[model samples]
Structures are given as structure tokens and as C-alpha cells.
Target: MIADDLSSKIRGGELSPGVALPPQKELSARYGVTLATLRQALQQLEDDGLLSQQPGRGTFVAEPRAAYRLDSLRGFAEDLRAQGHLVTTQILGQTVAQPPAWAAAHFGDADPAVRLERLRLLAGHPAVHQVSWIHGLELAETDLSGVSLYAALAEHGIAVHRAGEALRPGVLDQASATLLRQPLGTPAFHSERVTYGLDDRVLVADRATILGSMMEIRTEREVSGLSMQWVQLG
Candidate 1:
């Protein structure tokens, strides 16, 4: 297909987010040209973050970029401290076990000996609980205790390519209610995540249910092609 034509379609939102584009072979056949022609088109789209290619999953239209400014949200500790709230983490749990079911699978064929887990706090309140899993298998020695998981991963030169979050509301489960100090069955927000490594490998899966009473979240995406899907119950 003509690069100009393809670019116009994307710009017009005709080929919207999460929509898959025709395969290179198909585009080639339709455009009556070589695969190289199609690759050039896909390259341009990818550079713009409007299209994504997954070898096994094929290519698909990307979602809109979010507008949540990373700078506006105070870092966990600083934000709470600013409010005069003491932030402390009791280390409710820590382990380097197999990635939990919630974590995105790293390498489809990785051996079972790789994962990272932690329970974190904000203002002495349980705010983030996480598990990181990756295929490097070499990642077992990475210390994640009180260190930000992202920081630890970066120390080893592993940059996260992109990540997605799925949030939903639910009555707190027994364990969650107890931890977050809500009455049994109180409402909560479960933020589930699937983080990816620079190579597009799933690197972490996290399930954190926060007290809904204290937080409201909003994100805007029109440039980065990342997405956050959330449901509100309270």
C-alpha cells in the first residue's frame, strides 16, 4: 500500500487502536509489490507508535497514548510525607518464588526458577504489592526488597518497553480487607498489571488492591499508544 495512504488512514483513526492490520504478505499482494514495500509502511507506523508487531501475535493497531503526567504524581514516600503521614512498609511478605498467576508470563518456555515478590507501603499503609518475573533466569540474584522494582531492573540494563494496567472494583477479599483495614466486604480497587521488557517479553505481573476511599485515578492517552482500562464500583 502507498505509505501516504496508510499514514492517512491511521491519522484519520480509520485503523484505530487495537485493530490488526493486514499481514505483510497480504498487503504486498494487494499493493502488487514486494514484502519490503509493506515493511517500509509498517516501519513508519511503528515509529509513530500507532502500530505494534508481535511475532507470534501478529500486528495490531495500538491504543491511544495516555495523558497521565508522570511528574504530577508525587513519589510514594514524598507524597505521603507531604501530607504529614508517616509512610512505612512492614514487609508483609517477600520471596523470589515462581511468578504468581497474576503476573504476565515472561518467556513461554522459561524454567520455573525465576521470579520476584514484595509487599510495599505508602504512609504505613499497604499501597503496592508486586511480583516480577522474567526469562533471564539470571535475574534471580536481583535484590528487590525495599528498592523500587523498576529501579532494580534498570540497574541491570533491562529497560521496560511498555506495560499495561487493568483496574477493577471489587469487595475486598478477606485477606485484602484485613491488610487494608477495611471492614469485611468493603469496596476496593484491584489494579492488575502486565509489564513488559524492552524486547516485548512480559516481565512482571502485579495484583494490588488499594483502599478505594483514599484514591481516585485518571489518565489521558493520545500520544504514547499505551492504555489503562479501569472499572469503578464505589
Candidate 2:
């Protein structure tokens, strides 16, 4: 009962994010419960991601985790921005060059491709590091700084019809850890995607590493319309 009540208050914004809760003793008295019972309720809230407990500092409401939609075709920054998240993109590098072996395999050719590297921050924190190889689109490094890559592609008359993606659990490497400001071996999600245009031609091959602690993958499904499939990889 106490957990439910506090959960409601937190969700309703009565307990705003970063706001500290009252002292445990005081809260116990107000709730007419023992300190042990009160702590249990607070533990429940913390487990539900509604609160955070610091060792030296008191408990505070936790900032919400970003929900990454697994079912969306939108670009990462674009999807989060639409949810009212403060997203910023830093172009690490952009160059017209021969595609890397892995990216070349997806494009099925050795044709020159534009390689764009980007680091995305959410609420001023590093969230995603991405590199993309484009086959048909010509883009300046500045073209993607303030807009979605998909939007830029659309402006060039390319529309994404569908994409095939694979995801696997990984730990951050030295370079990725430095970019994300996390220690080496920090948990992350690694994704590879090949997107096709409306004409059924491969347009872009992308690789992205996402911070596991800051983002949550979410999807909704009904009995008739499932959004997920599992593939057994050797």
C-alpha cells in the first residue's frame, strides 16, 4: 500500500525528480509505520526506478530513463527529440572514402561511400556513439549537426522503406569508453543496421553503441502484430 501511494505521487510529479524525500523517521511517523517498514517501501520505490538512495546524502527522486523504441524506424536523435528530450549531436568526423570491410559487405561493392561519425548526448550526457556509411547520399559534415540523418536523406529524395538490424550485448572498448566518458568494460548495446530506400537499394549501413545505463529498449505488441523476432547466431 505504501509503495503504491508513493509510486503514484512520483509518477504524478508530486515528488519531482532530484527532490529529496523527508527524513526516514519523519516519514515513518507520518505514515504510522515502523522505520523498518518505511525503509522497505522506499526500497520498493528505488527498485521501480522512482527514487535513488545515496550513501552520504538522503534519497532523491531519480531522473527518468530514456525509452528507446525498438519498433521505430526514426533516427536515434530524432526519436528522442520528439519525446521532448534534450538531444545534441557532435560530429566526430565526416569523410568520403572507401567503405570499411564490414560496411562494404553490406553495400555489396567497393564503391566510395561517405563515412560519418557522430556522438549523441542526451540531457548533456553521452548517450550514443554512431558511425554510418552512406552509398548514394552526399552530405557535408555540417548537414547533420542540427537535424536528423533521416531528414537529410529525405531532402535528397531518399526515403527509408525498411531496415534489417542486429543487436548484441557488449562492453565498451577504450575508444568508445573515452567517447562516452565511461570506464572501459562498461555495459552497452551494440547495433548494426542496413537500411534500404524505397527503390529497394541499400542506402546506409550503420553501427551504434548505446549506453546501457541511460537508455531502455521498449516495444509494445499485440496478439496479431508482434514487433520482435529472435535469430540464432552461430
For model 1, how big is the CA root-mean-square deviation?
A: 18.2
Question: Compared with the true structure, what per-residue lDDT tens digits does model 2 show for residues 13-95?
Answer: 79888999989999899899999999999998997778999988999999877888877889888889877788999999988
* lDDT of each residue in 1-234, candidate 1, tens digit only: 467777688768688767888878888898888998788878888766667888988888765332212223222334445544445544444444554444424346434545554454653456544444554555666554455556666778877676666667767778776666667887666766666787787665566665665444554566665354445555
Candidate 1 whole-model C-alpha lDDT, 0 to 1: 0.60
In order, candidate lDDTs are 0.60, 0.88
Candidate No. with top lDDT: 2
Cα RMSD, each candidate = 18.2, 3.6
Compared with the true structure, model 2 gives a TM-score of: 0.82
